[model samples]
Target: MKRAVIGTLLATLAMVAHASTPRDLESSAVVDGTLVLAKNGTVQTVQIKDEARYGKPIADMVRKAALQWLFYPVLREGQPVLAKIDMHVRVVLQKAPDGNYTARIKGATFGDMDAKSTDALSNAESNKRIAPRYPIDAARAGVQGTVYLALRIDRSGHVTDAVAEQVNLANIGPDSALRQFRDEMAKTTLAAARRWTYQVPTTGRLASQDHWTARVPVTYTLNDRGEANPDSVWRTYVPGPYTKAPWSDKSDMDSVDAVVNDDVRTEGAGPALLVSFHQG
Candidate 1:
């Protein structure tokens, strides 16, 4: 059923750190909101904290998921206290072979959780990555966030399978326009991810592992100018047989391409906000 997604307020979430990210299932839905809990720790209800992105569809979804949420009541002096807190929730969207889509909650974050988070975000640093082109639709709409991927790397360092794990957009709403853009953007990311290959470690530290299966995070952020410059780059990779990335032009070995700022280059790529969860 369609639901209203919780919003991101200027407020904060204080979730218990005992519960962390959910590793299984599929669907990409991240949310930000507040929970009003009864003194006994029972959830009274939730309210969307951010400006409404999508009108009715997501709000309804938010309502449904909130009802199923299990929160530990905040206790003080050995008793429950009515509490209001801020949080972020992420859900996974699973696409079957039939191309049908289904959603599942992947993770949620409390603004006041901990200095240490178990959700380890591993951006592929060692592999050569090609930065994806910002989709015209997304760029025009100024959508930006990270895209999480599950990659199966074979012994040869080739990406045997690369799946679009999640999208984490922050500035945009989940309206029909934004949703359409995210869908198109996901396709671009998946295509670029599949073509990635890393140099397999034959000798040094990783000699024991036969194949590496891991999560890769690719972030797509617009340049500070709010425009896709295709030149606003931050990191420069050394040009050579050993360190060249896809976004680099072989002839331009001395300079890193200005493909980012709003661009994400994937050798393996991989934020936060109380409000917009990349793909609402």
Candidate 2:
């Protein structure tokens, strides 16, 4: 996806947090005060209730809470002045689907480590890490082959290995060229893969372990006249590194990728072949 589109999508996703209610609110209070817009556009406030404690004296949080209460000081001919404001402390509760209970704080959104980390996994970050080694566009134009690599990501968010899972280039006029191209692309992609970082949420003070399996499709196309088509595509399939092996050697090798390729023959006029150099 384009960068702008991806950014817009992420923005939309972030807006979802507004609709989310805080799990606990009884412990939190809303500090009500009149927001006096100073001549310099800064807000000045007078605290009406001094009994409430916000754990930490964070000015930003206090200002945000005050703004939500709609307590702005009255202005005279665009002149700003200080005014009194009402603040209240209320206890809020949220009932979960499992009959569990949680505290809900008004105007406060609970921070979810998982959601935060997931949002950080932007396409730009992925591209920056993956582009150099794979040189995706160039590899596709040079050789008409598909290389499948299985990537193993360690707990440290590093690509430990990217082993060749499959290579499909049966009908190419020169198999050696296609194979070499596949090997080089595989090496490049794997080399870049090591630099890619996956998102891992924090579990309390410690970070939770995380791993991801992603498939990158690289295609080389040839027109009816045997010229590079630029649209022919091949894909890389990385099975779940953290989950159970989807297909064991003792089990049937037929997978969703295999089934789909079986149904659609590429320009090579046959189903794609997956030759495993080393079994996982």
Candidate 3:
């Protein structure tokens, strides 16, 4: 069966305090898990892989929210059937005017890990993921975002063309200024991506094709405090518009907007969510 994702509006949850703090106004964390959905489309069970790493309060809140989520049924042969999806949830931390901090569900996305889509190229090796240099202006301004990239690779595994499909900014500002930054970042990412190479599938259905188009994301972030960016913690950003690549298949446009930081230097990374569940 051709893989497909159920479409729905983004969900937001009410803010619940995790701890009292006035230091930072906004931050986010990504929670990875597996969700088992019943034929009716309700989440039957969820197992968070690193639940303890996010603390009990946040863990409990995530679990509660997951149970309440409703999804369109996954169909096999035109019949609703049980399905399991790998999900990634971005939990944002916000500080209220009163100096109290609360955690809320920012966004979530579902994907099938076992999907064998021939349209997307696979990563060759871990070391092959060469991260692009961060734009100087963006770094000076503390601007961060993920650049969704569309790359055209020849059968010989060399990138022949590259384009920035979208650029989501972490910090907010006027639309004009945001566009400027997006252009700057996209330019830098495209420069680097043009030099990238991928592994062509030898046994897949499209191996004989002259070229393959692949989609990836490149993230630009700063770690000024001498600490590596935590896998669990994510930067909250405003997503940019999706631009279809000229050589891309129209079906590729159906991808969700939720992007994860893991996509920055990795290949075939799952979608990272960017929706808010609740408002307080």
- lDDT (Cα atoms) of all candidates against the true structure: 0.45, 0.35, 0.63
**Runs in model 1 with CA error above 4 Å?**
1-129, 203-206, 228-280
TM-score of candidate 3 on Cα atoms, chains taken together: 0.58
* Deviation (Å) of 35 in candidate 1: 33
Off by over 4 Å in 3: 1-29, 35-45, 52-85, 89-120, 125-129, 204-210, 225-232, 250-280
The best candidate by lDDT is 3
Against the true structure, whose TM-score is highest?
Answer: 3
Residue ranges of candidate 2 with Cα displaced over 4 Å:
1-126, 132-142, 201-214, 220-253, 256-280
Q: Candidate 3: lDDT of 160?
A: 93
Whichever of 2 and 3 has more lDDT, that candidate is 3
Q: Please provide, for model 2 over 1-280, each residue's C-alpha lDDT reduced to its tens digit, 9 standing for 90 to 100.
A: 4656434433443343233443321122333233333433333553433423333343344554444433223344555444332222222334677967454323211112122334222122564535434334323333334444444445555555455454443222223333444565556655765566644323322234354333333333345554545431222211211222242222112221221111111111111112221121
lDDT value for candidate 3? Answer: 0.63
